[model samples]
Target: MSWMPPDLPSAARARLEAARVLVVGLGGLGAHVALLLARSGVGHLVLADADRVEAANLSRQPYFPEHVGRLKAVALGELLQRIRPQMGVTLVPQFVAPDALPRLAAGCTAVVEAVDDAATKAALVEAAVAAGFRVVSASGIGGVGAGLAVRRLGRLVVVGDECTPCAGATPPLAPRVTAAAALQADVVVGWIVGNDSGTED
Candidate 1:
């Protein structure tokens, strides 16, 4: 019944188990973040996304072929439940409105922003921070061969390069996108374990 890895301190594992996270997208980055958090023993996750799985998402996101045409939130929720059947997962099948973010984030220890739109990301970050929840926002994982980086500004932690945009020009291959998502997940874990100095390079 113990979920902690042997190397993980009991205190850290307890912290992770008590944490609730809200993931505000189910794309490549959000999918990875949610999956990692579940595997890492986060007790609860609220997944919000309006889009359905598409064939194109299979290349970079975590959806299986069978998930295509299903709601991303529902698909990811099912996958997370399969991974950790005891974990609490709430699926919101519609896009989260910016004004509702504070209410959604009220009890969450952190908010992970994996939406593609810059404006939406900004609004989410602002709302999460204002609500006193740690926020991790992703950007620039659309291209190939770019390394990952984590930077913190105030209560907001930004993961991935600031230069890469997911325009039609460069496809978001799985490697780079997953790498960014891993970084986002790691940052959240760090915060949960009280090891984040808020200035990771």
Candidate 2:
């Protein structure tokens, strides 16, 4: 792809093409994260989401009127494949729990924790780490402002305001959500390139 710079060390390019990243959600955040990662040359993607798309998801998520009533993972997988014809995306059309992560992650080198719930996020992080995958996660992606930033804590890089929680009034907005996805993709790409200098928190 044009985006995969020719100057990148051939080894790094190979690593990216061989990398398998598990993105744990297919909503506002996960949608963009998966898209950006695919564009960045991450070859294989495992997308897990049980939820179906609805009209409500059109605002912040990358869904369209035609996508309503379709499975999120399926829809997103279709979109990704359209963007990168050779991109390999494994669609797991169910909510993957911690117990299922190891099997799902198998050869994956990185994990993106883009789920919406706190419980799921915590469990996925623990399991992804135990599975030995470099992880980047999101938290506090609610009601936007200028507070969103990236913080790398050891093996995990978290991006968000780190304050606002997703509520009715404090909903996830597209700009902030896409911004967070960009940061998450950056960290994942860094890991693929062997230059993951996680910022000091």
Candidate 3:
């Protein structure tokens, strides 16, 4: 697996090549976004996922069963390397503490929140805003129909909604989560390429 020349808008390709994108989860949505970014030639990817692959994760998560019990961050990093051997990535396996947000986001041009907890997502949103970084977040992605919604965090734009993951009241649809992840990646890439108008913002 080596670097395949990226086929993207010239400006977007360069921006992607030089950008640092911090992904906050490595579950279903995070897994898809991470894979897309790496394959698309994003220069730096900071992945944080304090969880490991569980049997329940196989259906949606892209990692192999051999990855079961392995830390999501590390496992995903390896998979990314296999996909695009030349991609540069820094995998962090710890949760992002409130106090550490600024330092984590220091040089990042954008942040993508894919954590499963509402409170944590809110905290990440606040942190990204505080750090003046653009953010693309996932919300209501699981328990819903296939859909895409892009929003804004302060003046910066994001790719998802504020709706919490559909709780027990509403059941989650498997296909929706997959679609949502692709939508999240699209919004972020659109922003990096300067095409996002936040029409749904």
Q: What TM-score against the true fold does each predicted structure earn?
A: 0.93, 0.93, 0.87
- lDDT for 95 in candidate 1 is 83
**On residues 36-94, what C-alpha lDDT tens digit does candidate 1 reach at each position?**
99999999999999999999889899889999999999999999989999999999989
Compared with the true structure, the alpha-carbon lDDT of candidate 1 equals 0.88
Model 2, range 85-201, lDDT digits (tens) per residue? Answer: 897989999999998998898898888899988998999999888777778999888776767777888778888878756446657778888888888888888888888845679
Per-residue error (Å), model 1, residue 62: 1.0
**Lowest lDDT block of 10, candidate 2:** 163-172
* Candidate 3 collision pairs: none
In angstroms, the error of model 1 at 21 is 0.3
Clashes of 1: 0
Per-residue CA lDDT of model 3 for 1-201, tens digit only, reads 434364555777788788788888999889899888777678888899899999888877887989999999999999988887777789889988856877887788778788888898888878777777888776666455545676654645555444555446444444666777777777777767677646643
The C-alpha RMSD in Å for every predicted model, in order, reads 1.8, 1.8, 2.5
When summed lDDT is taken over every stretch of 10 residues in candidate 3, the lowest stretch is 165-174
TM-score of model 2 relative to the true fold?
0.93
Alpha carbon deviation, residue 78, candidate 2 (Å): 0.7
| Ranking, lDDT, top scorer first | 1, 2, 3
Instruction: Score candidate 3 by lDDT.
Output: 0.77
